[model samples]
Target: MEKKTYIQAFCTIENNKIVLNGETVFESENTGFADFSKKAYQHFEIGYPKFFKMDNLSKLAFLGSELLLKAQNPNDENNTALLFANKSSSLDTDVKYQNSISDKENYFPSPAVFVYTLANICLGEISIRHQLKSENSFFIFDAFNAAFMADYANILIETQKAKNVLCGWTEFFGEDYKAFLYLVGNEGAIENTKQNLEILYNK
Candidate 1:
Protein backbone atom coordinates (compact mmCIF):
# COMPACT_ATOMS: atom_id res chain seq x y z
CA MET A 1 0.00 0.00 0.00
CA GLU A 2 1.20 3.46 -0.79
CA LYS A 3 1.55 5.96 2.00
CA LYS A 4 -0.81 8.89 1.80
CA THR A 5 -0.30 12.53 2.67
CA TYR A 6 -2.61 15.40 3.61
CA ILE A 7 -2.63 19.12 4.04
CA GLN A 8 -2.58 19.55 7.79
CA ALA A 9 -3.00 23.34 7.75
CA PHE A 10 -2.72 26.25 5.39
CA CYS A 11 -2.44 30.01 5.52
CA THR A 12 -3.01 32.72 2.92
CA ILE A 13 -2.05 36.38 2.92
CA GLU A 14 -3.19 38.82 0.28
CA ASN A 15 -5.25 41.94 -0.40
CA ASN A 16 -4.13 43.24 2.97
CA LYS A 17 -5.52 40.31 4.88
CA ILE A 18 -4.25 37.15 6.54
CA VAL A 19 -6.35 34.01 6.52
CA LEU A 20 -5.49 30.83 8.37
CA ASN A 21 -7.41 27.58 8.31
CA GLY A 22 -10.34 29.25 6.57
CA GLU A 23 -10.50 32.09 9.09
CA THR A 24 -9.61 35.72 8.57
CA VAL A 25 -7.12 36.09 11.37
CA PHE A 26 -5.72 39.54 10.55
CA GLU A 27 -6.37 42.30 8.05
CA SER A 28 -5.72 45.97 7.40
CA GLU A 29 -7.54 47.49 4.46
CA ASN A 30 -5.93 50.92 4.07
CA THR A 31 -2.38 49.88 4.81
CA GLY A 32 0.41 48.83 2.45
CA PHE A 33 2.59 45.76 2.82
CA ALA A 34 5.02 47.41 5.21
CA ASP A 35 2.37 48.66 7.62
CA PHE A 36 0.19 45.62 7.20
CA SER A 37 3.02 43.14 7.79
CA LYS A 38 4.28 45.14 10.77
CA LYS A 39 0.80 45.21 12.29
CA ALA A 40 0.36 41.50 11.62
CA TYR A 41 3.70 40.87 13.29
CA GLN A 42 2.56 42.90 16.24
CA HIS A 43 -0.86 41.20 16.41
CA PHE A 44 0.83 37.82 16.47
CA GLU A 45 3.49 39.25 18.78
CA ILE A 46 6.25 37.53 16.79
CA GLY A 47 9.24 38.90 18.70
CA TYR A 48 11.92 38.09 16.13
CA PRO A 49 13.89 41.22 15.38
CA LYS A 50 15.26 39.69 12.16
CA PHE A 51 11.74 39.82 10.74
CA PHE A 52 12.01 43.58 10.43
CA LYS A 53 15.29 43.23 8.58
CA MET A 54 13.93 40.89 5.88
CA ASP A 55 12.69 42.07 2.51
CA ASN A 56 9.03 42.16 1.51
CA LEU A 57 8.96 38.69 -0.06
CA SER A 58 10.63 37.12 2.95
CA LYS A 59 8.28 38.98 5.25
CA LEU A 60 5.28 37.70 3.32
CA ALA A 61 6.38 34.07 3.46
CA PHE A 62 7.38 34.42 7.09
CA LEU A 63 3.92 35.56 8.15
CA GLY A 64 2.14 32.64 6.46
CA SER A 65 4.64 30.03 7.62
CA GLU A 66 4.48 31.37 11.15
CA LEU A 67 0.81 30.47 11.46
CA LEU A 68 1.04 26.93 10.10
CA LEU A 69 4.34 25.92 11.73
CA LYS A 70 3.43 27.38 15.10
CA ALA A 71 -0.03 25.86 15.12
CA GLN A 72 1.02 22.22 14.79
CA ASN A 73 4.78 22.15 14.80
CA PRO A 74 5.79 18.87 13.17
CA ASN A 75 8.26 18.18 16.00
CA ASP A 76 10.86 16.92 13.49
CA GLU A 77 12.27 20.11 12.10
CA ASN A 78 15.29 18.33 10.61
CA ASN A 79 13.11 16.61 7.99
CA THR A 80 10.54 19.23 7.10
CA ALA A 81 11.30 20.28 3.56
CA LEU A 82 10.30 23.69 2.26
CA LEU A 83 9.04 23.93 -1.30
CA PHE A 84 7.90 27.38 -2.36
CA ALA A 85 7.04 28.83 -5.78
CA ASN A 86 6.35 32.31 -7.03
CA LYS A 87 5.64 34.07 -10.29
CA SER A 88 7.68 37.19 -9.58
CA SER A 89 10.72 35.32 -8.21
CA SER A 90 12.25 38.16 -6.22
CA LEU A 91 11.83 40.62 -9.07
CA ASP A 92 10.20 42.97 -6.62
CA THR A 93 13.38 43.37 -4.65
CA ASP A 94 15.44 43.19 -7.77
CA VAL A 95 13.68 46.27 -9.08
CA LYS A 96 14.29 48.10 -5.85
CA TYR A 97 17.93 47.09 -5.83
CA GLN A 98 18.32 48.21 -9.41
CA ASN A 99 16.99 51.65 -8.52
CA SER A 100 19.55 51.95 -5.75
CA ILE A 101 22.57 51.41 -8.03
CA SER A 102 21.01 52.74 -11.25
CA ASP A 103 22.17 56.27 -10.70
CA LYS A 104 25.89 56.47 -11.40
CA GLU A 105 25.92 59.78 -9.58
CA ASN A 106 24.38 58.19 -6.47
CA TYR A 107 25.99 54.74 -6.92
CA PHE A 108 24.48 53.34 -3.76
CA PRO A 109 23.96 49.57 -3.33
CA SER A 110 22.63 48.26 -0.08
CA PRO A 111 23.74 44.81 1.05
CA ALA A 112 20.56 44.41 3.06
CA VAL A 113 18.36 44.94 0.01
CA PHE A 114 20.67 42.98 -2.24
CA VAL A 115 20.44 39.97 0.05
CA TYR A 116 16.82 39.27 -0.87
CA THR A 117 17.28 39.27 -4.65
CA LEU A 118 16.55 35.57 -4.81
CA ALA A 119 13.11 34.16 -4.06
CA ASN A 120 14.55 31.20 -2.15
CA ILE A 121 15.76 33.52 0.60
CA CYS A 122 12.30 33.32 2.11
CA LEU A 123 12.81 29.59 2.58
CA GLY A 124 16.10 30.34 4.32
CA GLU A 125 14.33 32.66 6.72
CA ILE A 126 11.75 30.01 7.52
CA SER A 127 14.44 27.35 7.94
CA ILE A 128 16.42 29.45 10.37
CA ARG A 129 13.32 30.25 12.40
CA HIS A 130 12.07 26.67 12.47
CA GLN A 131 15.58 25.19 12.56
CA LEU A 132 14.67 23.11 9.50
CA LYS A 133 17.72 21.50 7.87
CA SER A 134 16.04 19.39 5.26
CA GLU A 135 15.82 19.79 1.51
CA ASN A 136 14.41 23.07 0.16
CA SER A 137 13.85 24.55 -3.28
CA PHE A 138 12.21 27.60 -4.83
CA PHE A 139 10.48 27.37 -8.19
CA ILE A 140 9.59 30.16 -10.55
CA PHE A 141 6.57 29.35 -12.63
CA ASP A 142 4.46 31.53 -14.85
CA ALA A 143 1.44 30.47 -12.81
CA PHE A 144 0.71 28.29 -9.82
CA ASN A 145 1.37 24.69 -10.87
CA ALA A 146 -0.66 22.76 -8.39
CA ALA A 147 0.00 19.42 -10.10
CA PHE A 148 3.75 19.77 -9.96
CA MET A 149 3.72 20.94 -6.37
CA ALA A 150 1.52 18.05 -5.34
CA ASP A 151 3.73 15.52 -7.09
CA TYR A 152 6.97 16.93 -5.78
CA ALA A 153 5.77 17.04 -2.19
CA ASN A 154 4.37 13.54 -2.40
CA ILE A 155 7.68 12.23 -3.68
CA LEU A 156 9.54 13.86 -0.84
CA ILE A 157 7.22 12.38 1.76
CA GLU A 158 6.98 8.95 0.11
CA THR A 159 10.68 8.64 -0.49
CA GLN A 160 11.34 9.56 3.14
CA LYS A 161 13.48 12.49 2.05
CA ALA A 162 11.30 14.61 4.32
CA LYS A 163 8.83 13.76 6.99
CA ASN A 164 6.72 16.84 6.29
CA VAL A 165 6.67 19.23 3.40
CA LEU A 166 5.93 22.91 3.62
CA CYS A 167 4.63 23.78 0.20
CA GLY A 168 2.87 26.73 -1.49
CA TRP A 169 3.01 29.70 -3.77
CA THR A 170 4.25 33.04 -2.40
CA GLU A 171 4.30 35.89 -4.92
CA PHE A 172 5.24 39.45 -4.01
CA PHE A 173 5.80 42.33 -6.41
CA GLY A 174 5.14 45.93 -5.52
CA GLU A 175 1.51 46.60 -4.49
CA ASP A 176 0.55 43.10 -5.51
CA TYR A 177 1.24 40.09 -3.29
CA LYS A 178 -0.24 36.69 -2.46
CA ALA A 179 0.93 33.77 -0.34
CA PHE A 180 -0.55 30.32 0.22
CA LEU A 181 1.39 27.87 2.40
CA TYR A 182 0.29 24.42 3.51
CA LEU A 183 1.84 21.59 5.49
CA VAL A 184 1.95 18.12 3.93
CA GLY A 185 2.31 15.17 6.23
CA ASN A 186 0.84 11.78 6.93
CA GLU A 187 -2.19 13.24 8.75
CA GLY A 188 -4.75 15.88 7.99
CA ALA A 189 -8.38 16.24 6.93
CA ILE A 190 -7.55 17.27 3.38
CA GLU A 191 -5.94 14.75 1.07
CA ASN A 192 -2.90 15.82 -0.90
CA THR A 193 -4.15 15.95 -4.47
CA LYS A 194 -3.74 18.31 -7.38
CA GLN A 195 -7.43 19.08 -7.49
CA ASN A 196 -7.57 19.66 -3.76
CA LEU A 197 -4.53 21.89 -3.94
CA GLU A 198 -6.17 23.92 -6.70
CA ILE A 199 -9.31 24.27 -4.65
CA LEU A 200 -7.38 25.36 -1.59
CA TYR A 201 -5.25 27.74 -3.64
CA ASN A 202 -8.24 29.21 -5.43
CA LYS A 203 -10.43 29.32 -2.36
Candidate 2:
Protein backbone atom coordinates (compact mmCIF):
# COMPACT_ATOMS: atom_id res chain seq x y z
CA MET A 1 0.00 0.00 0.00
CA GLU A 2 1.21 3.51 -0.76
CA LYS A 3 1.75 5.82 2.18
CA LYS A 4 -0.56 8.78 2.50
CA THR A 5 0.88 12.29 2.20
CA TYR A 6 -0.75 15.41 3.58
CA ILE A 7 -0.34 19.12 3.85
CA GLN A 8 0.74 19.66 7.43
CA ALA A 9 0.56 23.42 7.24
CA PHE A 10 0.36 26.27 4.74
CA CYS A 11 0.97 29.99 4.76
CA THR A 12 0.38 32.94 2.45
CA ILE A 13 1.71 36.49 2.44
CA GLU A 14 0.22 39.17 0.21
CA ASN A 15 -1.82 42.37 0.30
CA ASN A 16 0.00 43.34 3.50
CA LYS A 17 -1.56 40.35 5.22
CA ILE A 18 -0.09 37.06 6.36
CA VAL A 19 -2.46 34.09 6.26
CA LEU A 20 -1.68 30.72 7.77
CA ASN A 21 -3.91 27.69 7.41
CA GLY A 22 -6.77 29.89 6.21
CA GLU A 23 -6.40 32.26 9.13
CA THR A 24 -5.05 35.78 9.00
CA VAL A 25 -2.25 35.71 11.51
CA PHE A 26 -0.85 39.12 10.74
CA GLU A 27 -2.04 42.17 8.84
CA SER A 28 -0.19 45.43 8.36
CA GLU A 29 -1.38 48.87 7.42
CA ASN A 30 1.84 49.72 5.60
CA THR A 31 1.47 50.25 1.87
CA GLY A 32 4.93 49.24 0.65
CA PHE A 33 6.29 45.72 0.53
CA ALA A 34 9.52 46.68 2.26
CA ASP A 35 7.90 48.31 5.22
CA PHE A 36 5.13 45.73 5.43
CA SER A 37 7.57 42.82 5.33
CA LYS A 38 9.84 44.33 7.95
CA LYS A 39 6.95 44.98 10.24
CA ALA A 40 5.70 41.47 9.69
CA TYR A 41 9.12 40.13 10.56
CA GLN A 42 9.19 42.14 13.74
CA HIS A 43 5.69 40.98 14.60
CA PHE A 44 6.87 37.40 14.35
CA GLU A 45 9.86 38.29 16.54
CA ILE A 46 12.19 36.35 14.31
CA GLY A 47 15.70 36.93 15.64
CA TYR A 48 17.45 36.11 12.39
CA PRO A 49 19.25 39.34 11.45
CA LYS A 50 20.17 37.95 8.04
CA PHE A 51 16.53 38.32 7.00
CA PHE A 52 17.00 42.06 6.58
CA LYS A 53 19.86 41.50 4.15
CA MET A 54 17.90 39.24 1.83
CA ASP A 55 16.24 40.51 -1.35
CA ASN A 56 12.53 41.23 -1.37
CA LEU A 57 11.78 37.84 -2.93
CA SER A 58 13.79 36.04 -0.28
CA LYS A 59 12.17 38.03 2.46
CA LEU A 60 8.73 37.14 1.14
CA ALA A 61 9.49 33.42 0.90
CA PHE A 62 11.36 33.37 4.18
CA LEU A 63 8.45 34.92 6.04
CA GLY A 64 5.93 32.45 4.65
CA SER A 65 8.22 29.52 5.43
CA GLU A 66 8.82 30.77 8.94
CA LEU A 67 5.13 30.81 9.74
CA LEU A 68 4.52 27.35 8.31
CA LEU A 69 7.55 25.75 9.96
CA LYS A 70 7.58 27.64 13.25
CA ALA A 71 6.46 25.23 15.98
CA GLN A 72 7.13 22.10 13.91
CA ASN A 73 10.90 22.68 13.95
CA PRO A 74 11.55 19.91 11.40
CA ASN A 75 15.24 20.76 11.48
CA ASP A 76 15.76 17.79 13.79
CA GLU A 77 15.01 15.44 10.88
CA ASN A 78 17.28 17.37 8.52
CA ASN A 79 15.41 15.76 5.64
CA THR A 80 12.86 18.36 4.66
CA ALA A 81 13.27 19.13 0.97
CA LEU A 82 12.30 22.56 -0.29
CA LEU A 83 10.30 23.07 -3.47
CA PHE A 84 9.45 26.57 -4.63
CA ALA A 85 8.24 28.31 -7.80
CA ASN A 86 7.57 31.81 -8.98
CA LYS A 87 6.36 33.55 -12.12
CA SER A 88 8.54 36.66 -11.81
CA SER A 89 11.65 34.58 -11.09
CA SER A 90 13.71 37.14 -9.17
CA LEU A 91 13.06 39.97 -11.62
CA ASP A 92 12.61 42.29 -8.67
CA THR A 93 16.19 41.86 -7.53
CA ASP A 94 17.44 41.66 -11.11
CA VAL A 95 16.07 45.13 -11.67
CA LYS A 96 17.81 46.39 -8.57
CA TYR A 97 21.13 44.83 -9.51
CA GLN A 98 20.72 46.12 -13.05
CA ASN A 99 20.19 49.65 -11.83
CA SER A 100 23.37 49.46 -9.76
CA ILE A 101 25.45 49.03 -12.91
CA SER A 102 23.19 50.71 -15.46
CA ASP A 103 25.16 53.94 -15.11
CA LYS A 104 28.82 53.34 -15.96
CA GLU A 105 29.86 56.64 -14.40
CA ASN A 106 28.15 55.94 -11.06
CA TYR A 107 28.62 52.20 -11.37
CA PHE A 108 28.35 50.46 -8.00
CA PRO A 109 27.24 46.91 -7.60
CA SER A 110 26.62 45.32 -4.22
CA PRO A 111 27.43 41.65 -3.93
CA ALA A 112 24.58 41.30 -1.47
CA VAL A 113 22.05 42.26 -4.13
CA PHE A 114 23.75 40.19 -6.83
CA VAL A 115 23.65 36.98 -4.79
CA TYR A 116 19.84 36.73 -4.80
CA THR A 117 19.41 36.99 -8.57
CA LEU A 118 18.01 33.46 -8.71
CA ALA A 119 14.65 32.50 -7.24
CA ASN A 120 16.27 29.51 -5.53
CA ILE A 121 18.10 31.82 -3.15
CA CYS A 122 14.85 32.13 -1.26
CA LEU A 123 15.04 28.38 -0.64
CA GLY A 124 18.61 28.85 0.53
CA GLU A 125 17.45 31.39 3.07
CA ILE A 126 14.83 28.95 4.41
CA SER A 127 17.34 26.12 4.44
CA ILE A 128 19.93 28.15 6.28
CA ARG A 129 17.40 29.21 8.87
CA HIS A 130 16.00 25.70 9.41
CA GLN A 131 19.35 23.94 8.93
CA LEU A 132 17.77 21.80 6.21
CA LYS A 133 20.20 19.95 3.89
CA SER A 134 17.87 17.79 1.87
CA GLU A 135 17.44 17.78 -1.89
CA ASN A 136 15.67 20.93 -3.05
CA SER A 137 14.29 22.25 -6.33
CA PHE A 138 12.95 25.53 -7.70
CA PHE A 139 10.91 26.12 -10.83
CA ILE A 140 9.68 29.01 -12.97
CA PHE A 141 6.22 28.90 -14.54
CA ASP A 142 3.68 31.29 -15.97
CA ALA A 143 1.57 30.77 -12.83
CA PHE A 144 1.18 28.45 -9.89
CA ASN A 145 1.65 24.90 -11.18
CA ALA A 146 -0.30 23.08 -8.52
CA ALA A 147 -0.34 19.72 -10.29
CA PHE A 148 3.38 19.65 -10.82
CA MET A 149 4.07 20.82 -7.30
CA ALA A 150 1.85 18.11 -5.82
CA ASP A 151 3.29 15.35 -7.98
CA TYR A 152 6.86 16.42 -7.31
CA ALA A 153 6.40 16.57 -3.56
CA ASN A 154 4.71 13.17 -3.46
CA ILE A 155 7.51 11.62 -5.48
CA LEU A 156 10.02 12.74 -2.88
CA ILE A 157 7.88 11.35 -0.06
CA GLU A 158 7.10 8.05 -1.80
CA THR A 159 10.77 7.54 -2.59
CA GLN A 160 11.64 8.13 1.07
CA LYS A 161 14.23 10.66 -0.03
CA ALA A 162 12.77 13.21 2.36
CA LYS A 163 10.78 12.91 5.54
CA ASN A 164 8.76 15.90 4.41
CA VAL A 165 8.73 18.53 1.68
CA LEU A 166 8.24 22.22 2.21
CA CYS A 167 6.89 23.58 -1.04
CA GLY A 168 4.92 26.42 -2.63
CA TRP A 169 4.91 29.52 -4.83
CA THR A 170 6.75 32.71 -3.83
CA GLU A 171 6.17 35.53 -6.30
CA PHE A 172 7.50 39.04 -5.91
CA PHE A 173 8.31 41.57 -8.61
CA GLY A 174 7.96 45.24 -7.95
CA GLU A 175 5.02 46.03 -5.62
CA ASP A 176 3.12 43.03 -6.93
CA TYR A 177 3.86 40.04 -4.69
CA LYS A 178 2.35 36.85 -3.25
CA ALA A 179 3.76 33.88 -1.37
CA PHE A 180 2.03 30.58 -0.64
CA LEU A 181 4.00 27.92 1.28
CA TYR A 182 2.90 24.44 2.38
CA LEU A 183 4.49 21.50 4.17
CA VAL A 184 3.91 17.99 2.82
CA GLY A 185 4.42 14.91 4.97
CA ASN A 186 2.87 11.59 5.92
CA GLU A 187 0.63 13.12 8.55
CA GLY A 188 -1.91 15.93 8.46
CA ALA A 189 -5.59 16.60 8.17
CA ILE A 190 -5.40 17.52 4.49
CA GLU A 191 -4.39 15.13 1.72
CA ASN A 192 -1.64 16.17 -0.64
CA THR A 193 -3.43 16.45 -3.99
CA LYS A 194 -3.44 18.96 -6.81
CA GLN A 195 -6.99 19.99 -6.07
CA ASN A 196 -6.26 20.46 -2.36
CA LEU A 197 -3.05 22.31 -3.15
CA GLU A 198 -4.91 24.69 -5.40
CA ILE A 199 -7.64 25.13 -2.83
CA LEU A 200 -5.12 26.00 -0.12
CA TYR A 201 -3.17 28.22 -2.51
CA ASN A 202 -6.27 30.07 -3.54
CA LYS A 203 -7.28 30.49 0.09
Candidate 3:
Protein backbone atom coordinates (compact mmCIF):
# COMPACT_ATOMS: atom_id res chain seq x y z
CA MET A 1 0.00 0.00 0.00
CA GLU A 2 1.11 3.56 -0.70
CA LYS A 3 2.10 5.52 2.30
CA LYS A 4 -0.34 8.16 3.42
CA THR A 5 0.93 11.69 3.62
CA TYR A 6 0.30 13.66 6.86
CA ILE A 7 0.91 17.15 8.03
CA GLN A 8 3.67 16.69 10.56
CA ALA A 9 3.64 20.28 11.71
CA PHE A 10 2.38 23.66 10.62
CA CYS A 11 2.89 27.33 11.37
CA THR A 12 1.04 30.54 10.58
CA ILE A 13 2.34 34.09 10.75
CA GLU A 14 0.19 37.18 10.33
CA ASN A 15 -1.06 40.21 12.21
CA ASN A 16 2.28 40.40 13.97
CA LYS A 17 1.65 37.00 15.47
CA ILE A 18 3.17 33.55 15.04
CA VAL A 19 1.14 30.41 15.55
CA LEU A 20 2.62 26.91 15.58
CA ASN A 21 0.39 23.90 15.51
CA GLY A 22 -2.54 26.14 16.32
CA GLU A 23 -0.78 27.54 19.38
CA THR A 24 0.19 31.17 19.63
CA VAL A 25 3.93 31.12 20.28
CA PHE A 26 4.83 34.70 19.49
CA GLU A 27 2.97 37.97 19.20
CA SER A 28 4.22 41.50 18.98
CA GLU A 29 2.77 44.98 18.79
CA ASN A 30 5.30 45.95 16.14
CA THR A 31 3.43 47.32 13.16
CA GLY A 32 5.84 46.33 10.39
CA PHE A 33 6.67 42.87 9.16
CA ALA A 34 10.37 43.49 9.75
CA ASP A 35 9.90 44.34 13.40
CA PHE A 36 7.43 41.55 14.02
CA SER A 37 9.73 39.00 12.41
CA LYS A 38 12.70 40.16 14.42
CA LYS A 39 10.72 39.85 17.62
CA ALA A 40 9.71 36.34 16.76
CA TYR A 41 13.27 35.37 15.88
CA GLN A 42 14.54 36.73 19.18
CA HIS A 43 11.70 35.11 21.09
CA PHE A 44 12.49 31.74 19.53
CA GLU A 45 16.21 32.19 20.22
CA ILE A 46 17.05 31.34 16.64
CA GLY A 47 20.80 31.77 16.57
CA TYR A 48 21.27 32.00 12.83
CA PRO A 49 22.97 35.35 12.30
CA LYS A 50 22.21 35.26 8.58
CA PHE A 51 18.56 35.76 9.40
CA PHE A 52 19.35 39.32 10.40
CA LYS A 53 20.65 40.08 6.90
CA MET A 54 17.64 38.76 4.99
CA ASP A 55 15.02 40.99 3.46
CA ASN A 56 11.52 41.16 4.90
CA LEU A 57 10.19 38.47 2.56
CA SER A 58 13.02 36.03 3.32
CA LYS A 59 12.73 36.78 7.00
CA LEU A 60 9.04 35.90 6.94
CA ALA A 61 9.65 32.65 5.05
CA PHE A 62 12.63 31.68 7.20
CA LEU A 63 10.77 32.27 10.44
CA GLY A 64 7.71 30.37 9.31
CA SER A 65 9.78 27.34 8.26
CA GLU A 66 11.89 27.56 11.39
CA LEU A 67 8.85 27.29 13.60
CA LEU A 68 7.32 24.49 11.57
CA LEU A 69 10.52 22.41 11.50
CA LYS A 70 11.53 22.99 15.10
CA ALA A 71 10.49 19.58 16.33
CA GLN A 72 10.43 17.69 13.06
CA ASN A 73 13.92 18.28 11.77
CA PRO A 74 14.58 16.16 8.75
CA ASN A 75 17.11 13.35 8.97
CA ASP A 76 17.56 13.03 5.22
CA GLU A 77 17.96 16.54 4.00
CA ASN A 78 18.74 15.36 0.50
CA ASN A 79 15.33 13.77 0.12
CA THR A 80 13.39 16.75 1.38
CA ALA A 81 11.54 19.01 -1.01
CA LEU A 82 10.65 22.67 -0.67
CA LEU A 83 7.56 23.97 -2.45
CA PHE A 84 6.61 27.58 -1.86
CA ALA A 85 4.23 30.11 -3.40
CA ASN A 86 3.21 33.71 -2.96
CA LYS A 87 1.09 36.45 -4.50
CA SER A 88 3.37 39.45 -4.55
CA SER A 89 6.48 37.62 -5.74
CA SER A 90 9.41 39.91 -4.95
CA LEU A 91 7.74 43.26 -5.46
CA ASP A 92 8.72 44.44 -2.01
CA THR A 93 12.41 43.96 -2.61
CA ASP A 94 12.12 45.02 -6.23
CA VAL A 95 10.77 48.37 -5.17
CA LYS A 96 13.54 48.78 -2.64
CA TYR A 97 16.22 47.88 -5.18
CA GLN A 98 14.61 50.07 -7.81
CA ASN A 99 14.55 53.01 -5.47
CA SER A 100 18.23 52.50 -4.68
CA ILE A 101 19.19 52.86 -8.36
CA SER A 102 16.33 55.03 -9.57
CA ASP A 103 17.97 58.16 -8.24
CA LYS A 104 21.10 59.05 -10.17
CA GLU A 105 22.11 61.12 -7.16
CA ASN A 106 21.99 58.02 -4.98
CA TYR A 107 23.00 55.43 -7.64
CA PHE A 108 23.44 52.99 -4.77
CA PRO A 109 21.94 49.62 -5.43
CA SER A 110 23.08 47.51 -2.53
CA PRO A 111 23.98 44.01 -3.57
CA ALA A 112 22.41 42.79 -0.35
CA VAL A 113 19.09 44.27 -1.43
CA PHE A 114 19.46 43.21 -5.04
CA VAL A 115 20.12 39.59 -4.07
CA TYR A 116 16.63 39.22 -2.65
CA THR A 117 14.80 40.71 -5.62
CA LEU A 118 13.69 37.26 -6.68
CA ALA A 119 11.00 35.36 -4.78
CA ASN A 120 13.00 32.14 -5.08
CA ILE A 121 15.83 33.61 -3.04
CA CYS A 122 13.90 32.80 0.10
CA LEU A 123 13.83 29.16 -0.94
CA GLY A 124 17.56 29.24 -1.47
CA GLU A 125 18.09 30.74 1.96
CA ILE A 126 15.94 28.09 3.61
CA SER A 127 17.69 25.30 1.74
CA ILE A 128 21.07 26.61 2.76
CA ARG A 129 20.10 26.81 6.41
CA HIS A 130 18.62 23.31 6.44
CA GLN A 131 21.26 21.89 4.08
CA LEU A 132 18.37 20.67 1.96
CA LYS A 133 19.66 19.59 -1.48
CA SER A 134 16.57 18.30 -3.16
CA GLU A 135 13.78 19.31 -5.41
CA ASN A 136 12.61 22.89 -4.85
CA SER A 137 10.18 25.23 -6.56
CA PHE A 138 8.44 28.58 -6.16
CA PHE A 139 5.14 29.73 -7.61
CA ILE A 140 3.26 33.01 -7.85
CA PHE A 141 -0.51 33.29 -7.81
CA ASP A 142 -3.24 35.80 -7.19
CA ALA A 143 -4.01 33.94 -3.98
CA PHE A 144 -2.84 30.91 -2.06
CA ASN A 145 -3.33 27.90 -4.33
CA ALA A 146 -3.62 25.26 -1.65
CA ALA A 147 -4.79 22.58 -4.06
CA PHE A 148 -1.77 22.82 -6.31
CA MET A 149 0.69 22.78 -3.44
CA ALA A 150 -0.97 19.79 -1.80
CA ASP A 151 -1.14 17.80 -4.99
CA TYR A 152 2.38 18.64 -6.08
CA ALA A 153 3.88 17.76 -2.73
CA ASN A 154 2.10 14.45 -2.76
CA ILE A 155 3.45 13.79 -6.20
CA LEU A 156 6.97 14.32 -4.99
CA ILE A 157 6.43 11.90 -2.12
CA GLU A 158 4.57 9.33 -4.23
CA THR A 159 7.28 9.30 -6.88
CA GLN A 160 9.92 8.74 -4.19
CA LYS A 161 11.59 11.92 -5.36
CA ALA A 162 11.27 13.25 -1.84
CA LYS A 163 10.79 11.63 1.49
CA ASN A 164 9.53 14.81 3.07
CA VAL A 165 8.07 18.02 1.74
CA LEU A 166 8.24 21.45 3.31
CA CYS A 167 5.73 23.66 1.57
CA GLY A 168 3.94 26.91 2.27
CA TRP A 169 2.62 30.25 1.10
CA THR A 170 4.66 33.29 2.11
CA GLU A 171 3.50 36.67 0.86
CA PHE A 172 5.12 39.92 1.78
CA PHE A 173 4.55 43.42 0.50
CA GLY A 174 5.40 46.44 2.57
CA GLU A 175 3.93 46.22 6.06
CA ASP A 176 1.44 43.56 5.07
CA TYR A 177 2.76 40.00 5.09
CA LYS A 178 1.75 36.47 5.96
CA ALA A 179 3.39 33.02 5.98
CA PHE A 180 1.82 29.63 6.41
CA LEU A 181 4.16 26.60 6.32
CA TYR A 182 3.64 22.91 6.91
CA LEU A 183 5.71 19.74 6.79
CA VAL A 184 4.26 16.72 5.08
CA GLY A 185 5.42 13.25 6.06
CA ASN A 186 4.11 9.73 6.38
CA GLU A 187 2.68 10.17 9.85
CA GLY A 188 0.78 12.89 11.63
CA ALA A 189 -2.58 13.93 12.99
CA ILE A 190 -3.93 15.56 9.84
CA GLU A 191 -3.88 14.11 6.35
CA ASN A 192 -2.07 16.19 3.80
CA THR A 193 -4.88 17.29 1.53
CA LYS A 194 -6.03 20.46 -0.17
CA GLN A 195 -8.98 20.91 2.15
CA ASN A 196 -6.86 20.50 5.27
CA LEU A 197 -4.28 22.93 3.91
CA GLU A 198 -6.93 25.53 3.09
CA ILE A 199 -8.49 25.13 6.53
CA LEU A 200 -5.16 25.46 8.28
CA TYR A 201 -4.14 28.39 6.11
CA ASN A 202 -7.44 30.13 6.90
CA LYS A 203 -7.11 29.36 10.58
Q: Per-residue alpha-carbon lDDT of model 2 for 1-203, expressed as tens digits?
A: 26779998888888999988888999989679999998998999998999989999999988988887785854534888998998999899999899999999999999888999888998888888988888898999999999999889989989988989989799998899989998898888999998998888887
Model 3: per-residue lDDT, tens digit, 5-117?
A: 98988999999888899999888996677677777888999999999999988999999888766676547566779999999999999998999998999899888898999
Q: Is candidate 1 or candidate 3 better by lDDT?
A: 1
Better-scoring candidate (TM-score), 1 or 3: 1
Q: Which candidate tops lDDT?
A: 1
Of 1 and 2, the candidate ranking higher by TM-score = 1
lDDT of 1 by residue, 77-162 (tens): 67899999999999999999999999999989999899899889999999999989989999999999999999999999999999
* Ranked by lDDT, top first: 1, 2, 3
List the RMSD of every prediction in angstroms.
1.2, 1.5, 1.6
Candidate 1 C-alpha error for residue 142, in Å: 0.7
The runs of at least 3 residues in candidate 2 whose Cα sits more than 4 Å from the true structure, single-residue gaps closed, are 73-77
Record all residue pairs in model 2 with backbone atoms less than 3 Å apart, i.e. clashing. Answer: none
lDDT, model 2 = 0.89
Top-scoring candidate (TM-score) = 1
Query: Of the pair 2 and 3, which is ahead by TM-score?
Result: 2
